[model samples]
Each structure stands twice: as structure tokens, then as C-alpha cells.
Target chain A: MDKIENNKAWFLVLPVFVIVAISAIIPLMTVVNYAFQDIFSPQDRYWVGTEWFESVLADDDLHGALIRQFVFSFVILLIEIPLGIALALAMPARGWRASLALVLMALPLLIPWNVVGTIWQVFARADIGLGGWLVNALGIPYNYTSDPVAAWLTIVVMDVWHWTPLVVLLCYAGLRAIPDAYYQAAAIDGATPWKVFRHIELPKMRGVLLIAVLLRFMDSFMIYTEPFVVTGGGPGNATTFLSIHLTKIAIGQMDLGPAAAISIIYFLIILTLSFVFYNVMTRMGTGERA
Target chain B: MSLQLQGIARTVGGSIHLHPVDALLEPGLHVLLGPTGAGKTSLMRLMAGLDAPSAGRILQDGQDVTGVPVRQRSVAFVYQQFINYPSLSVFENIASPLRLKGQERGAIERRVREVASLLHIDHLLDRLPAELSGGQQQRTAIARALAKDARLLLLDEPLVNLDYKLREELRTELRALFERRGAVVIYSTTEPIEALTMGGSVLVMHEGRVLQAGPTAQVYHHPASEAVAEVFSDPPMNLVNVEVTGGTARFPQGLELPLTGHLGMLEDGAYRFGIRALHLALRPKPGLPFLPARVELADISGSETFVHVHAEGLDWVVQEEGVHEHGLGEPVTVYLDPTRLYAFGPDGRVRAAPARGRGG
Candidate 1:
């Protein structure tokens, strides 16, 4: 059989290339351009050549925001992964109850980000809100508006409530895809419930668990709107994550050159972290034991 | 250990899956021979306590264990699909059951290696199930079951997923393995050759009912009904409808044979005559009754030949040893010794004595 070399097939991909260039490449190149130039006005721009990059890199506020972003992502991951798995395990395996549980678990994920933040803000208000009244009545001084620690706890709790459902849904799907034979075999082998979970359920959910971790990490790392809407990045910057800080530099302070440089660095950090995570997870998933 | 099923039945979604069944099984290899959907797996599940019977109780050692959970019972079930802990190496997979029992690590390793070597998989211990072939994965599953040393081992067509050569090899190994093990082993298969080769008691099942059960050779030679006969033959039992008037039964082609033995006692009416493929000889022998047939197709499978013939509106398969060629649409004469024939009444129940007799 002769191999067919059809160069005309490239014509079919031309539209995709055009769309990507317009939506992604051109905007990225504009950011790169802005990162190197100091603009006094629309027409009075000068080449700064690494000056903005150096200043952005040396900024202490950006460093604090970076560390806070890391801490937030790591903490959320630690809570959500195990909680999601437990929720999935406790869920019904069949019939109408399974369907009902899936729908209820998906409710938080379906709400818009701003709406979630608004809901939490009003719900956590110290005055006239049930949650605030109940917490204060319990004698734990609870006011997110003035206390940095309270504000930080509220944000973390809100984030978990909003995003842990995504992990639960993923892990649930992974759990459902396993054939019944494995469970039957385990039962026949006199396997305890914990052993069955450790040997069968957890291993089978590895792929989806990795996917959940990656998605939650990226989403939490780039988190902005919820905290902005709730605390306005306040309680004296207790929850001003990387996205909010970048926005403050670019839009609030009107420092485009340094903001663009900071944006580029932030993008690199996320890319490197995601790449490292993906490689490590895939290796563990397919690795052989000696 | 002794296992007994007392009127056990299963019904799923308002349809009967297994009719009420009663049987006592001792420790040995017992083949559940039936076609697919014959309630073999359902019955096995009830005995293993994986599923509760809708009607009756299951007893082990004369004690009722019907409502007991599978984990509490000393039983192991191997499904047709090869199932293993995919992330665990073969060693760990085999040791999982022992570890679950809280056995010491040293004893677990020793038993795992023993079963692995018994199943000829010792060298592949470190490889995960995903890295092994279909046969090796099933072997690992069986070895795991053997390592558990459960009192009752149920295998539901465990070799149906493997290639032919691998199935043959494992069948021999399993036959030997079950013979030595004290556990009550119940193996199910749709293939008659497997039942015959395993050499144990055979339970012939059809349409959710047990048609017959006895020693493998006895059941093969003396099936209790037409269903049992069909379930016990490979190319299937060739059944021809015949009319009986006096002391002789006449075939559709006007050939007559004397019904002088136990067949003589049956009422004169429409009866079905069944003969195994191997009993239908290709050449005419002296003193043997013969039937004329038109060859429709001849399938030669190396050592054996199956000749499909059409005669008097019925299709007949004749098995001949070695290579025998018959051209399509050719008229041929096939001989049948009347003593080896089976007589069934119009209701599909066997009438003649099961054992062979000298030609009269």
C-alpha cells in the first residue's frame, strides 16, 4: 500500500490557527511589548529594557502575595481531596438515591463565583446573620469585617464550600467506573473495609484524583473575585492573593509596565508548577514496583 | 466441608432467575454444565453468600448460612473476567487475602509464593496485573483464591476469557489442583468438553432448573432428559422425531427398528430418538441399523471431523474420528447401533434405560 501525503488537509486547520493567533498569541505579544516599555502617555512610550522586570521582581508586597497564594492552594488541596473522597465513599452506589446525591453535591459548583462570594459575605455578617449570631453565641469572638484571622478563616471556608464539590464529583465518577467484580473479589478474599478502600478504591481513583488536584490548585492559585467581593482584599491584606495584587498594580495603581512584568512571572510560576505536578502524578500512576 | 442447597431460588426484577433447587455437594470438583443464562452463576452466588436466595436456605456443615455475608463465609469466587488489584504486583495481589485476614507478613509471603509456584507464576511476581497477559492475570486470581484456602471455591467460567491453548493448559492444572484441595470446588462452564475433561460430578442445568446430576461419566452416558442430553454433548445430541405404532418404531424415511427392550414398555405414540454424534458411524457395520442422509457440510478440525447431514427434514451431526471428507450435497449412509440409541417421549423425557445393551 502506498502512503497518501495530502497537503490540502492543512487548509482545514487554518481557521483554528487564525482564531488562536487572534485570541491568544496577539494578546500575549502585546503584554510582552508592554512589559519592556515605560509609557508616559498613549503616544509617548520609551523602551525600559528590564527596568520594570527588575522592580517587579524586587517588590516585597508581590512576594507576600505569592507566599499567601501558595499557602491557600496547599491548604485547600489538603482539605478538599480527603473530604471529597469521604463524601464519595459515603454516597449511595445505586438507584434513585445515587442520582439525588450527585445532584446535591453538584449544587455548589453550579453557582457563579461572584454569587458564591456574595452569599458568603451576607451569610457571615455579624449582625442579623444566622451564622454570625450562632458563632458569637458560642462565645468565640467572630467578626470577619475587622479581624484578619476571622477574615482569612471565612475565605478558606467559603473556598472549600464552593470547590470541594468539583473534587467530589470527579472522585465519584472514578469510583462508579470500577467494575463490580473487584469488590466481589475483595469480599470473597475476606478483605476488611479499610483494606478494600486502600487496595482497590484508592488505586482506581488515582487518575481522577490527580485531575481534581490539578484543577483545584490552578483555580485556587488564580483566585480573585470571591475574596475581592467579600473582604475587598482587606482586613489589612490578609487575603489579597496573587490575582488581586496583580490587579491592584495594573488597574488601581496604573503601573502597566511593572504589572505586565509581574503577570509574565506569575504565568511562568503557574506553568512550572502545573507541569511538575502533571509529570509527578503521571509517573506515579504508571510507575512499576521493583 | 459439605454444602447443601435446600430449595434455593433467586428472582430479580420480577423474573425468575433460578428456580427452587435442592442438592447436597461434597468436597470435590463439581462441574455446573449448562448453556449461558442457565442459573449457574446465580446458584453459585447463593452458595457463596454473595446473594441471598429468595426462597430457600443454604447450609454448610448442616448449619444455615444463607443470610451470612460473603466476607463472613469461608468462600472465594473467581469471575469470568480476570480481576486483580491492578496497582499491586502479583505477589501483593496473591497476598492481599492473607493480609486481610491479619496473617503475619512472613506467613503471607510464604503462602503467596507457594500458590504462585503452584500456578506456575512464581517468576512473574513483581509484575502488576496490567503488565501481564490475560492468562497470567487469571492465574493470579486463582492463586489468590487458593492462598485464601477458603472452604468453598466457586469459579464462574474462569477460563472462558483466555485463548484456546491457555484454557486447555489451565484446565488441566485446575483439575489437578481441585483434586488435591479439600475445598468444595464448583466450576461452571457452557462447554461440554471442559466438563468431560475435569472428571468430577456434573450437574446439568437448563432454563433455571437442574435436569440431572451425577458422576461425570454416568451423567454423560445416561442423561435424565432431552435437555440434559443436549447440555452434555458438543455438536449437540441429534434428535429425530419418530412414530411408533406396534413393537417397532419407524423413522420418517420408513426405516424401522424393533423396540424390544425397555423402549417396548413406552406407549405407542410420537417419540423422539436421540443419538450422540459419536454414535453415528460413517461406515455401515454388519447387523447395525443405518439411515441415509444428504451431506450439507463437513467440518474437519484436525483430529476430529463433524459432518452435518440433512435427512427427512432434520439436521444431524455425525462425529468421526480422524480426517474424513464428505462432499456437499452428497448422499451418504450413516449407521447407528440401536442399542446405543435413546428414546424420548413426546414430552421430552427420556424413556429408555440409560446404559447400553447388546443388539437384539
Candidate 2:
């Protein structure tokens, strides 16, 4: 068979390249440029190669913030994934109740991140809000502004409240894609509910779960707004995550070179971790099928 | 074992899926023959205990099991779709039912291997369902169902999704397998030839009711009504309006046949005549009427040919034994033997059936 020869389609993609260069590539390249040079102004700069990188990599504050970021992301994933799955499983399968439940689950996700932070901020106040006042009434002496432990708990709970719905929605979509025949077959096999979840539901949800895990991991790693509004980097630097610390160095103290270096490093860290997470999940999914 | 359905019916969301079905199935193959959306699956699901009937009771060997769930019954079901555990290897998929029953490891292994070999899927044991072809995946599902050793097996058009050759091969193997098993096998299919080839008692269903149920050959030879005859045919039996008066039956195409054999028993009134596709012949006999027909379509399917023609304002299909070429709009003559004609009354009831012809 003689195939049609056409080369006109290649020129159609030029506009997309131009738009991406203007929107993303150019900004990213400027950051890369700043990371290599100590820029006081566009006209006054020194080619201080790797100096900012070395200093940013060795800073004690950077190291502390990095560890804190990792722990927060880890805890978020640990709490959110299973909780989302359980909630999705508990949701009604059909009718008006299912539609209402879906709407309720999506309510928290629709709120703006900063707005969510402010709502939690006021909602956790011991004097006026229900959450903290109820906790104080139980004699726990809860106050997010004064105690580092209370601040951490408040931030974690707020993030869970705002984001677990994404995971639930993803898993629920995956659950609904499965045909009813599998469940009937499992029932005929006399499989218990746990076994059905393990063998049928979990395996069928693997693709969506991978997306959920990676999205949650990357989003939580880069999380800044809600925690910043709620804790302002904590009672005494306890919640100063990498993004907040970078913002402090870049804007508050105005160290452009070091902050640029930290930004590049932060981008690289998220990219590398997301890559590793994706590969491991896909490999695990195929390993069973293989 | 015996499974009895007492007026079992199913209604979903104000629509009836099955209506008051009563059946007694013994430990043998029973083929449910019907077209799509004819309630074959709904009836089978009720029998499998997968769905609760809106009315009536089901008894297993005289024990009521109407309220029982599928897990409590000794029954296995295979859907038309090749549904296997996509994440499990063929061996584990087959072993699932056995393992669920808490059989010993040795017993599970032995039974899985035995059923896998029976289905000719033993070599694909280590491969997952995703890794196998559709036919092999369906065979693995069948193996899993067989490993359960259930007293009742329900296969709902299991081969309907396969290619033609694979369908033929699996049908042969499944019939052989069902022959030796003591389970009451209820297989549902829309193909009448498949039911006949399986050679079992058949339940002919139309709309939401079983129009007729009897031995396969008996139902094929003498369908209870025109509805049953249509459901039990492939290209559909050719029907033509007829008038019987003055002791002679007259066709609309100006062909006449003297009342003889089964036609003699019919009263003088309007009737419908039915002729199977294969009984319409291109070569004419001395006693049969030679009606002129115009070829509408000639479908040459491998060794057989189905010639669709228009005669007397009605279209009819003529099944030729070999590949015969006929061009569209070409005039041809078709002969219908009076002895092979079936007479139906005004209400579609089979009034008179022809005597059993050669290989009918």
C-alpha cells in the first residue's frame, strides 16, 4: 500500500511551542540563569558558579525544612489514601443519595486553598471556634497559636479535610468503572468482603490509585498556601516547609541567587521523587499481571 | 439433582424482565434459546440465586432456596463476557473457588490442574487473563467454574462473544464436558443451531416468556406457536398468508396445494404457512409449486448460501447447501414441498405440523 505523504501538520504545532516558551520555558531558564550568577541587577552580576548551590545545599535551615517537608508529605499520604478508599467504599452505590454524597465530598475540594486556610485558622481558635473550644472543654488545653504540637496537628487535619476528597473521587470513579459481573462472580465463589476488596476492587483501582498517590505526593510536597496562612511557619519554625523557607529567603531577606538555587533544587526534588513513585507504582501494577 | 422454579418472575423499575417462569431442570443440559432481551439472562440469574425474584419460590431437590444468596448455593455462573480475574494468573484464577471453599492446598492444586487441562488451558496457567487471548480467557473462566464442583452450572451465552471457529470448537468441548457432569447445566444462547448441536432439552423464550420447552428435536420439529418457531430459527422461518377453502389451500402467489396429510385436518379458514429456509429449493419437484421470485441478495457464507428473494410481496430466505451465485434483481424459481409446510392459525398457534421429513 502506498501511504499518503504529508508534511503540512508539523507547522501546526509551532504556536504551542511558542506559547510554552513564553509561559514556562522562559521563566524556568531565567531561574536557571540566576542560579549560576550572583545578580544584584540585570547590569551588575558576577558569574559565581555553584557557590549559591553549595551554600543552599549546606544550610542548616534548608536541611531542617527539607526533613519537615518529607515528614508532612509522608503523614498526609499515610492518612489520606486509606481514609479516602474507605470513604469511597462506604458511599452509596446509586440513586439520589449517591449524587448527594458526591456533592458533599467535593465541597471541601472546591474551596480556594487560602480561603480554606483562613477558615481553619478561625475554626481552630480556642476562644470562639467550635473545634478548639470543644477540645478545651475536654480539658486538653488546645491552642494552635501557642503550641507547636497543636499547630502541626491543626495543619495536618486541615490538609486532610481539604484534599482527601480528591483521592476519594478518583477511587470512586475507578470503582464505578468495574462491571457488575465481577462482584457476582466473586459472590458465587463465596469470597468474603475483604477478599473481594483485595482481589477485585484493589486490582481494578491500581491505575487510578497510582495517579492519586503521585498527585498527593507532589501536591503535599509543594504545599505552601494553607499551611502558611494557618501556621506562618509555626510557633517556632516547626512548620517552615521548604516552600515557606524558600519564600522567606527569596522575598523577605532578598537573597536572589541562593533562593533561585533552592527553587531549582526544589523543582528537581519533586520531579525526581515523582518519577521514582510513578515507576515503582507502574512496576508493581504490572508485576501482578505479569 | 433437581432444580424447580415455581412461577419465578423478575421486575426491575416498573419493567418486567421475566414473567412467571416455571421450570423443572434435572441433572442434564438444558439450553435456553432466545433472542436478545428475551429474559434468558434474568431467568438464569434467578435460577443461580444471584437475584431475588419479585414473586414465586425456587426449590432445590424439594428444599426452598428462594431467599438464599448466591454464596450459599452450590451453583456456578459464567457471563457472556470473558470475565476472569485480570490480576491473577490462570492457575490462581482457577484455584480461586477451590481456595475459597477451604480445600487443602494439595486438593486445590490437583483440581485446578485437572480443570485447566480439561479446558485445554493448562499451558497458560502462569499467564494472567490480560496476557491470554479472548478464547483462552473464557476457557480459564470455564475452568474456574468447573473447579467449584457445583450442582448447578449456568453459562449465559458464554461463546457468543467468540469468533465463529472458536465458538464451534468450544461448543463441542462444552457439550462433551456437560454430558459427563452430573450438574444441571442451563446454557443460554440465541442461536437455535447451537441449541440443536448441543442436543439437549431446550427452553424457547420470546419477549419475557418461555413459549415452548421440550426436547431439542421435538421443539424444532413441532414448535408450539409462530412465536416459538421464529425464536427457534436462525434467519427466521418464512411465513406467508394462506387461505383454505373448498378443501384446498391457496397461497397469495397464485400457487395451490390440495389438502392432504396434515393440511387435511385444518378447517376452511384463513391460515399462515411456514417453510424453513432449507426446504425452499431451487430445483423443482413434479408435485411442488414453482413460484417465480426475484433475487434481492445472495449471501455466500463459506459452504452454504442464503438467497434472499421477493415473491408475492414477501421476502424469503432459501438456504442452498453449496455456494450458488445469484445476482440481485435476477429472476429465479423456488419450490416449496407441501409435506414440509407448517400451518399456523389466526392466533399464531401451530395448528398442523408436517410429518417428520428426512433429517428434520
DockQ of all candidate complexes: 0.38, 0.49
TM-scores for candidates 1 onward, in order: 0.89, 0.95
Question: Against the unseen true structure, what C-alpha lDDT does each candidate score?
Answer: 0.90, 0.92
* DockQ for candidate 1, C-alpha atoms: 0.38
lDDT of 2 by residue, A118-169 (tens): 9999899999988989999999999998898999999999999999999999
Docking category for candidate 1? Answer: acceptable
All candidates: CA RMSD (Å): 3.6, 2.2
| Range of the 10 consecutive residues with the lowest summed lDDT in candidate 1 chain B | B351-360
Clashes of each: 0, 0
lDDT score at residue A255, model 1, on the 0-100 scale: 90
Give interface RMSD for all predictions.
3.1, 2.3
Number of the predicted model whose TM-score against the real structure is largest? 2
Deviation (Å) of A217 in candidate 2: 1.0
Residue B149 local lDDT, model 1: 95
